[model samples]
Target: SAIYLWRFGSIKSRILTVCQHFFFISFRARPLVQTFTSWKAPIIWEEMFDSILYDQGHTDKNSSVALTVFAVGRYLDAYLKTFLTSAEQHFMLGLPVTYYVFTDSPEKVPNITLASRRNINIVQVEKHTRWQDISMMRMRTISETIESEIRHKFHYVFCFDVDQEFKGRFGSEALGDSVALLHAHYYKLPKAQFTYDRNPKSKAFMETGDFYYHAAIFGGLWQNVKHLVDACYLGIIEDKLNNVEALWHDESHLNKYFWIHKPSKLLSPEYCWDQSIWDKRDILITRLVWAPKHYETLRSG
Candidate 1:
């Protein structure tokens, strides 16, 4: 009755009819708008999982472990070349591994059959224009990339910065349900120095020489990765809302959360030893880098 009166009646009715018509038109288009809004990088987690399992020689019944690396934008060409070579050699050799490189320059890097680049899904992340910007984005991208990998059906996921080279074995044995952190002897800091008022909601507590919570350089394992990423992102979102920037970028956020929450496992620095430090010993130095050209004699363990 109202529609009929509006369609054939006075000026006010005609105006109402036009308004109602537009409103209905917009309402009808809402689904299409939502569809477009949800569009993202073409990510098929299940398909990717299947491929990883099949390639690794894992049977249809067996489970597979996957390594996830986040390399996006214009990372150093040298680092990209070395990282690709080292990772491909280690994980792809004998394991049923699916290496996923979440990167922006997918086409630039040679897409290996064993390990391939996944589309970067996180949106509105500003490109790294300055050193400070790169530092900040590294934290955000690492968190988002880990979350993306966690969504995939894999037993384990290892997230690493592209700048590092893998010289040793990075298999399931080393990362059994715990987080592996590369101990950096050069920049070693006491646990007391790590304490901060950054996490206002949580109480600050530190023990005597508890060196475990010192670094956030490389951390992984499927469940632990998922947990850490979630914690880091949650902390970051809160910081963003409060207009607070972490001192160590996203690393600071990860440190804060992991400090309180506790990681499943903490792998020693031997797994991720920076090449510059020559005095430290023990464990295979799998990851090698040319941080200093003069330190070329340092073995790529």
Candidate 2:
């Protein structure tokens, strides 16, 4: 009888210990599951951004879109021909388009015969010795140009790097009141891992953020684009005043603006991809960005 009682007590104690351990694990896992469920990935889904089904023909007739690029020196001119030709072929095929080419040597711009509705306006800008200066200067030039020229001429504007080539259709489906592209490298990482300007002294600094947007591609309504450029230019000026430059120059400021302002539409990495470095299984190539030349050689005249 004594042996039976002892065995029964041991069994009961073991059962109670198992129950406590199971309950503790369940309790711990509950919050983790909630956190994952509540967290929203910044990626915009295909159904939301698909341009094929959108009535682009109707929108094209009514919209005037401007594409802006800054190719300041000789090295980038090699890329200009392909960039211009592809854009003519695939970008908003029937829309009234203007290519605002900001460059030091306007004559170097290819004399490609654009479609009747498409045209290139070469705006001469003073050449800068450093590519970094050119990158930062782009915002000031874009803001001033929009105030003086682009605002009255176009309904929408897109800014892109001159080094890229368009491999597939980059169409009106990308259009938005405000649009920003996720950086190809950091799109999948947690916000903590995003490469934002971390310096507290810089205006672009962010302790936490939702997306690390690429400055290479961004656009919106004339007003929104203007606001974006103006804000970035001002941020740069503030950094200059503080005697600190943000880590990635203009890109840092861009991420800062969109983090606070949150773009109305977010483009997937498919919009801007470095094909040479990445052969991502999930990414369908809409545009293929070429690897850039050596910074010193590319920027030097």
The whole-model lDDT of each prediction reads 0.45, 0.71
For 31-140, candidate 1 gives per-residue lDDT tens digits of 22111111111111111112232333333323355555555555523355566666676653454565556555566565444444222222334545554355445545
Residue lDDT tens for model 2, 223-256: 8898999898888888877788898988998998
Give candidate 1's TM-score. 0.59
Point to the candidate with the largest TM-score.
2
Clashing pairs in 1: 56-96, 167-286, 168-286, 183-269
lDDT value for model 1? 0.45
Model number with the top lDDT: 2
lDDT of 1 at 65: 55
What's the TM-score of each model vs. the native? 0.59, 0.80
